[model samples]
Target: MRCLLVLPLLLAAALAAVPPLLGPTLPPGTELRLLSADLRTLHGAWRVEGRRLLPLSPPLAPKAGQEVQLLLVLPGEKPRAFPGMAERGDVFLPWEKEQVSLLRLLKEVYGLAPPERLWP
Candidate 1:
């Protein structure tokens, strides 16, 4: 039935709109949605203004074999994540390559807008 076909499409669309849930819900205004085994996003980034990100939720500490993914959402493009690891009970995300890259991208939106770099 046409209804059956449309139902799946609607469900798929809705699922795409939702972000991934790993640890405690990340602080408000930030969501890390797992897109697949290798892709993900920080949904609702349009609300960010680029500044030091302080998590409102408890720190993110991945269990063994797990890693935290941070993705950047650019206009007309998909979200991007910097790859890194956070051991359990670390209490903070390390400012490593992936974290710094993610922060640089976010800074374009929330932190003071820099003109030298391009973000979209």
Candidate 2:
């Protein structure tokens, strides 16, 4: 019976490691490339505001904890490839100066903001 208690804890940890990316957590115009997943078998990709990826009609849906590479195409500069992961439907881009602008936009759009901005 000891295994019963441990089961829930193990499950929780696994889920926590790879949480779903939900709408409102991502902005439009985000580009993501799947690293390891079956495309043909997978139907329709995730979209912003629950939008789906295009060019493939049903874009490749990102799975929680799925590995991905982020291509941040900054203006006047070559697109930068950054390592990130998929959560929910959006890829979690690592912290960068550009995120400051992203955070501000999200605040205005969602009326919710990350507390990190409030401190210092």
The TM-scores of all predictions, comma-separated, are 0.28, 0.34
In order, what lDDT does every prediction score?
0.36, 0.41
Model 2 agreement with the true structure over 1-120: per-residue lDDT tens digits? 999999999976854443222232454444333343333333232223333332323345556676555443322445445455556544455454322122333334433333222112
| Residue ranges of candidate 2 with Cα displaced over 4 Å | 1-58, 96-120
Name the top TM-score candidate.
2
Any idea what lDDT model 1 has?
A: 0.36
Estimate, for each residue in 1-120, the C-alpha lDDT of model 1 and write its tens digit: 999999999977855433332222233344333222244432112222243343333332344334555453443455556444433322123442322333333333234332222121
Show model 1 residue runs off by greater than 4 Å: 1-47, 50-61, 88-120
> What TM value does model 2 have?
0.34
Best by lDDT: 2
Least accurate stretch of 10 residues (summed lDDT) in model 1? 41-50
